[model samples]
Target chain A: MTNTILVLESVVLVLLTVLVAGLLRSHAEILRRLHALGAGLDPDAPTSELASMPVELRSRVSGSFATAADLDGAGLRDDALHVAVVGTRHRTLLAFLSSGCLTCQTFWTAFGEPARLDLPDDIRVVVVTKDASEESVSALRKLAPPNVSVVMSSTAWSDYSVPGSPYFALVDGGAGRVTGEGTGAHWDQVKNLLRQAADDASDDSREVRIDRELREHGIAPGDPSLYRTAEQIAQESRA
Target chain B: MTTTLAAHGLAIGLPTGWEGRIQRRAVSVAAEQTHAVVHLANFALPEERDDFGGGVTPLMRSADVFVVLFEYGPDAVGKPLFATQGIPRVTADMFGSKRLQRPLPGQLGCQRFFTAHGRPFCLYVVAGSRAYLPRILAEVNGVLTDLDVAP
Candidate 1:
């Protein structure tokens, strides 16, 4: 009888140890999952990691810029003797420059080389300089790229509310809006501005297209159904 | 030497030497969520120009100041501050208070945090020269203290 009682006690101890170990393992798994969810929601998470997550998990971020002063009042050149900014069907890069600005001179010197600028083909480059006599701007005109349009406008500076020389504005002709505007002290900054504007334009076009398609199908782009399928469609299309 | 500037239910005094402009837009973050963003640009040295590098630098290339007001939904109350592109993260001491700063090239940068209203806002200021940082900070501190946000 003594031997049997000792054996039963040993069996109970073994069973209890196994159960505790199992509970600990399950708790560890739960903790790991919680950590992952926290990391996914972290704002500082890397772009690559955010991209891999589902769209619903990623939040939307937006930005805005001050309204650019109207260019209509700006008396742009339209004479046969000089190139005019007659609006283009595609996006236009309106580079505000002045002969009096040393910074503007640097930009013009670099802009004279089309190969160096290497702007996307879809974007049309137009240089808007202060209205000056042909003789006054003759030296600056010679530095302009052959393919780019150079226009002289008296009100261009104030119309755009340009803070300083070598300011740039990305004008979306189709939308009739200034997509992006800022001052660039170097040629590389100008290139970056163009690239960013191009990306923004592309995104805008995609959204517009999606909205139009949804409207055609008798569904509002704001409808919940559209969003439900947007991510899946975006994933498939991207793939 | 100051002018009254107002936007997003808030009003403040702007220095006379600065050119203040505001932009407002409605942004759709999710299908069921949409909010407004107010962007303000203050040009301190409109005539001066500086060579600020590209890629992560904020706008107002040469000594300029910018203020961005972001409105978040009720759900964002407890969330971390959303990281904005092009603004590098930094630690700085401002007016005897320690705050996280986002310093861009050319000494142009901003610092942002959630306000009492649960809205994320940023104040960006650029000095014409490094020597002007102290003066700029004082001015920025005044603006922050004087800001009147609508509840």
Candidate 2:
């Protein structure tokens, strides 16, 4: 071949090689992002599931009424009830709670019944609090998911199991095992796990009527007799 | 007696002569780059600290000092843009611990609190960052040095 032609061919080859490498690197980055999205759904799952499984609070309750009754019967008042509520979830919703927790206050504005309308019908959400009082629960209830259960467990502060506020767990109620648990920077990921748990339980046949169970345990369902009503709760506590 | 310290960053006014040394510092790895530290010397008498949970030295006690660090700036209102660091230590050891005490992550950031003199103060301290550390400390030290106390 002519010298000029040889030089031109070499130049073309180098350009093609660069283009190929660039494309591969870009492809890898895209795959990495896609994998991250996929991992949000399930560590081993594909990307398509992430969109289909946006973290949501399913409206339906988890845990057996029998179990809730058992907890109530055990005199799990105030904080203990909160623990039971957290324990009942298919996934643990770390209660970013404290009488003065700033994160919980931020989330109080972000999460709530009206805001969580976008969530599915079966996801169970709960609030964990260090200070479990009728007043605190009333204030928090205004900012929680509808039909989302709440528990104020001071024991959670010392559970030694939970490292900080806003910690979460994937609880298998049927198995009573914490299938997945984490703290700090994984709320969205844990929310995804909660949705996943609900999806997983879509096929499991177990139902617990919380109110009836509480009644059986001699704990009234609509509202505890300690306070006349939600409005009076704050005042009563102050008194 | 109510003594009001002028607004520097997140603090509106600190109670003067309340037996506390307020030092401000900028945090380097926090959402809010600037922060402050308020070390309340002679925080509480031994009895008061015991009345409340002991994990934190209650500001109401005599021996306890409330050391708090937060962000300060004009753009501080109604924004998730600051961090807070608090340490309940002894008045003698306010500056002993180099590591900032951490509260629950999301639970912290911004706050409004009252001092013993009933002066209102605001705070926003971000974690792991030190953007305005020097300025915060200088201003707080100046205030403490100039404080007029009632014996």
Candidate 3:
């Protein structure tokens, strides 16, 4: 009877050891996954929403911007061009990137120029970096598209809500709301969505017959930012 | 009782010993802080042997990339320590050898880890001071030992 009891006890101890070992191993895997963005980073989630946004919002999001504090720094620079900035009455695409981010550089290479081409002429591409120096500025100039206007600011880190090295947001400027935000570099999806939104705004305007009227008056809808209202902008050119 | 790291087919095992979920993908990597990893994989094939020389030479054959910051010891100064176990020796001849021709004033070292010779290389960095060198190597070796590459 004693022998039988001893054998049973040994079996329980072995099983417990195995169970505990498995638990710890599983725990370690969980920790690793947490470190790696909870499985893997998804870079293609937001590309389809580009065409559904409001024009004012889209224009502002994609237009050149000046954080209040950065304007002061730009004023201190040698070449202080009075760059055009869109007002905050609509949605815009705000991108935050770091000089040290390799992924940003990679994504930038794939999407930078092509992205600019897809945007309406008025939807300017703007970038805000954490530090602005002559050398860094020069490097950025080489990397970004011709249509891009880059800004260097110490306060960019704080103003951008850039929780990570590279992040992006589609903001509804009129509503003062974030339409969408992502933490990684997903250029294809972002470009597609932005293109779609631009197309939708254009399509919405086409239905109103405004393009012919603008032609008759000999006024081109030169700047998407200058128009006060979406209806007015969409209607002004209609016949 | 003692926690020792182990590897099981691309996934590292905890000291407690559990089965891993071999995702068979290169993980994203970052240095010290605020870097995010995405699951997109892009790999370019090296046509010539000289193409992947120096720091640019990938540690693996597969093109998937996983990033990690590599750290090493103070003793590794002036010497090129091969971080990957697959290639025991990475002589200057393999690369053009022009870049490291004149070693810097202080200890100049490189740090990285690998699962295979031509796959995604993990992140590693040897920056600033030699103070953290020993701790960095130990931590890296520990992580590497835990990784198991399947045949």
Per-candidate clash tally: 0, 41, 42
Q: Give i-RMS (Å) per prediction.
A: 16.2, 20.6, 25.1
Candidate 3 DockQ, CA atoms: 0.01
lDDT of 1 by residue, B1-151 (tens): 2445555455555543333333233334546653334333333211111222122134344434444445556676555664442222222343111221445445545455464554444444344334455666665556656556665
* Candidate with maximal DockQ: 2
Ordered by TM-score, highest first, the candidates read 1, 3, 2
Taking the candidates in order, what DockQ does each have? 0.01, 0.03, 0.01
CAPRI verdict on model 1?
Answer: incorrect
In model 2, what lDDT does residue A153 have? Answer: 47
Report how far off residue A102 is in candidate 2 (Å): 2.5
Measured as a fraction from 0 to 1, the native contacts recovered by model 3 come to 0.00
RMSD of each: 27.1, 21.4, 23.3
Question: Which of candidates 1 and 3 reaches a greater lDDT?
Answer: 1
What digit string (tens of lDDT, one per residue) describes model 1 on residues A76-142? 2112111212222456678887766555666777766767778775566667777665225656546
lDDT of 1 at A233: 83
